[model samples]
Target: MKELMKGNEAFAEAAIRAGCRFFAGYPITPQSEVLEYLSRRMPEVGGVFIQSESELAGISMVYGAAAAGFRAMTSSSGPGYSLLQEGISYIASAELPCVVMDVMRYGSGLGDIFTGQSDYWQAVYNGGHGDYRTIVYAPSSVQEMADLTVMAFGKAEERRNPVTILSDASISQMMAPVELPAMACHDPDAPAWALKGKGNGHFKRHTSVMYYMNEYDGYVRAKYEKIEKEDQRWESLETEDAEIVLVAYGISSRICEEAMRSARAQGRRVGLIRPISLYPYPVNAFDGLAPRAFLSVEMSALGQMARDVALACGMRAPVYSMLGGTRLYSCSDVEARIGEILGAAHGAF
Candidate 1:
């Protein structure tokens, strides 16, 4: 069975399918539909839905709910996400598990109700005040938006870490028919690894870093190092002997994909690496690209992931980027940039 659903609504449905019983959030577009959709459905299913005072308070409540050990989540956009980073870091530090869906819009300040992948760095790089890390899943389509949100909860708890669903305005607003997956009686969203509550179990203690250099320095490095070791994923398209590659995640990857198709029409051999998980970024994936590959790092932001890709690729090939401009990106934009990179591709290998 399939139904045409908004990306945000699908995300809520997917959380339900994943057995997410507790949701705490502050609404902000274009992700507000997700928050609003869940608000009604959760109570109908005997789940708890909380609309908190602010993004900070919302995630703080999420922290409490997650501490109590219910498969929990929250949703927001760029500005809202900025507000929630404090709690996100706290959740990461305490090693409490939760899922967050950042249905991004175009903005570094204020807010734009339009499409963009500008939050790529903020979501993956742990854009909070202190040192922290989380797993980020970028979804290109509405179906993926729903499915990824559900999977994020499971993966977050599996690692006893936070998992993020990264979708953009286009995907969130687009209507698509998504087939919901059937779930078993036993829900995997809330796993045995988390501390549910003190009801059947003993009370739990939660704490955050107090910034003692002597006490926290080594632990910080170890946690960050551990994060770097796990949670990296990428998808290879036409990668076999592909000389020049386009690297992107989220909605930008969709454009890159179409660009590859167009380039192929003109008989240009282009490849793409669409990273699914942003943190513990797929560095090794780029390393294995064909020698002539100069990674075209595409995003709607000002060269955030590009810098990371360059660090990952080193001198194997140049890492070029097309970033920071108004308006939604398209396959034509990708084609032009890729044409530029290919023009200079020969000597780099």
Candidate 2:
């Protein structure tokens, strides 16, 4: 049965169902509810929850817990998310599998407590100082908030690397009906690489400086390549015959979908491509489509996701940007922008 739940609460409960036994996070706007929800619930399930003194402390706690073989997680927003970058780099280097949720707010350097998609570059690209990449999922609805939290935990373990759920303030605070997943338990000692006590003598494992080895470099490269080839995910609507395709994710994608339907009703050849995975970046979704123009709609001052769309199309089509910054674009707002782009395209010929 589906229950009405806030987005942040849904993510927290979903993490528990996915067997996240240790959660460490500091409070931040638009995402504090995650930590708040976990505080009251983790103990009920015999899981560990810590309201850390800082984002840095929270992420480090997660690292330690994950190293000890527990499924661990952390949540933050904006600057708080920025503070986790260094720890994230360390966790990635250590090859630990854990989950991190960045409920993004607007702007840079202590941005406002409002929804924004500006963290696209930070989440998809490694903001941490490393050559490693984390799998990133962007959820547009409350249902995805629950669904993708479960998937993030599984993908993190399967790939043996940290996974991120990049949500924005709007989705993080909204309330909707969600069917939560079944509860499960994780065995901390299941992984061979996990730290065991001194009882297992003559064998020791270390997680640092292994990347300095030439062979490990090749292994990491191959692993990311495999992920790129196999894990790209997206949703396409009328793209098969679209002349102008709008590329978006998170809340912006929802608006684009509405605009697509509005345009289609009036006989406009508009389409939508909503990316679910940001790291491997659903490049495959662009396959065989020869749209004349690709428009990137995002809530960032600069269209952060436009570059990826341009690269995915191999510059075959001119890519445009519809930036919303601290606000969201309405269906009419998106529809008007599409008409303007189409008008300009017609004038060019």
Candidate 3:
């Protein structure tokens, strides 16, 4: 049904609909509503909901649930997500199918409960240890929170890898109209590798990454390469004939969308590339936009995404970064930044 729903609530409903039978999480701001909503709804739907003592414990529980061949998930913010890193790495190593949602908040250590994009690097690149990547989704709106979450689960299960929904306080707390999908039933058939009890008359084999190190490394690399080729997702706007392009993701993409409209109206040639899959990172988005200056806008003190843009563009164009920190950019702010970059380039002319 169509209704005005908070992003957290929308995502919780989506998880349920996506056949997420197990939810394990610790409450953290900007995302606490997800846990709270799931807590009340899970029991009604015959699902397991666990309020773990700590973020570490919560992700550990998710790991166990996922290993059992169930659609499992967890949610948290910055520091809490930091605590889940080891478990995430283990999940990656074991190639477990699961979903993790991070409603990003500010700071290195409990900076603030406010929204921030500082976690982009952590979400897309260094989620955990030992050269692995998860399918990361950046949702800009409440509706996308629901939609991409369903996609996240599907992708994780399809690839037998973990997927992350990397949102922020703005997207997590914002309310917007959304249509909930019909709930799907969770399947209980254990995978060939899943442990079955002794009485079940099956060989109970446990999942682990302890094998030939070289072979394991090669296997992981091959899997990631296939994901990179097939899973890169992005939206390009006005880039076919433009001098300046703005690259962004998550909520910043929404702001840039507005800015693009305004800039086009004002006769300033500005385009945009919004990355929906941050891990695979739409490098193709930068394929032909050479001889143009690029602006990477993000909500961080340093432009973590700009680094990726530079690499994707092959250092052919000058890439600039605008760090918004915890503050969201107004359309005017984006236009002004575009003007600054364009004007500076013109001055060089």
Candidate 4:
């Protein structure tokens, strides 16, 4: 059944249905509803819910729960997410499978409670210390917020690492129709590496940076290469014969989609490439695309994703950026920007 739901509520419900039995998080703007919804619902299904005093403690709790082989989760926004990075690093080093939601907000330290995508670098690059990467999912709509949360758990476990659902207050606070799945059942058997009850007189210690630290980098690199090859996902629109291709994701992609439509209507050959997995980044989306120009639209002062786009496209085409901080861009604003780039490139061709 389809229901009109806010983005936070949708992911919370989806997590519960995806067998997430433990939730630990503090109240933070934009994502507080996720904690609120899970607080009441987790207990109904015999799951554990914790209202940690701080985001640090909350993510720590998640690490503990996941260590015990339970599907665990935590949610927060920008500043709070930064505080939890230490725990996230530990979880990554220990190779624990868990889910984290970052409902992005604008600015740094005590920034506004409004929506922003400034955390793209934090989410896709150095989320924490060390040479580690978390699978990052960028959900543009309420339905994706829920659907991706469910998929995150599977991906995390399949890869035996943490996964981040990267979203912003805009999508978190907005309401949209979503079709939820049935509740999932937990697996009875704990993972072989988990610190479960004594097994055959063997002791298990879940430590950060698995034994043989020297070989750790090689191991992680192999996994990341596999992820890059196997997990890259994206959506492309009208790029077969286009002069400009817009690279965007999350909430910004929605605006760019509108811009693409308007540009097409104006007889401008424009297209879009929206990355669903921000960490893997879907670099192949631009492979072999002979566009006249590439524009990256993002909700941040710095063009974080633009750097990724330039790297992905190997600077095959001139790359441009349209930045939006706290406020989102309108279709017309993006349309105008696309026109500007295309017009400038017209003379070069």
lDDT for predicted candidate 1 compared with the true structure: 0.79
Q: Which 10-residue window in model 4 sums to the lowest lDDT?
A: 187-196
lDDT of 3 by residue, 177-209 (tens): 998877777675756445436565855544556
Worst 10 residues of 3 by lDDT: 204-213
* Model 2 ranges off by over 4 Å: 209-214
lDDT tens per residue, model 2, 226-262: 9999888888999999999999999899889999999
How far out, in Å, is residue 271 in model 1? Answer: 0.4
lDDT of 3 at 339: 87
Cα error of candidate 3 at position 290, Å: 2.8
lDDT of 4 at 250: 84
Cα-based lDDT for every prediction: 0.79, 0.90, 0.86, 0.90
Estimate TM-scores for all models.
0.89, 0.97, 0.95, 0.97
lDDT tens digits, residues 232-322, model 4?
A: 9899999879889998888899999988998899889999999999989898888899998999999999888999999999999899999
lDDT by residue for model 1 (91-209), tens: 98777889888988887898577887788778988788666778888888888877787778778777777888888887888899998766523253344444544677676567664
TM-score of 4: 0.97
Ranking by lDDT: 2, 4, 3, 1
lDDT, residue 123, candidate 2: 90
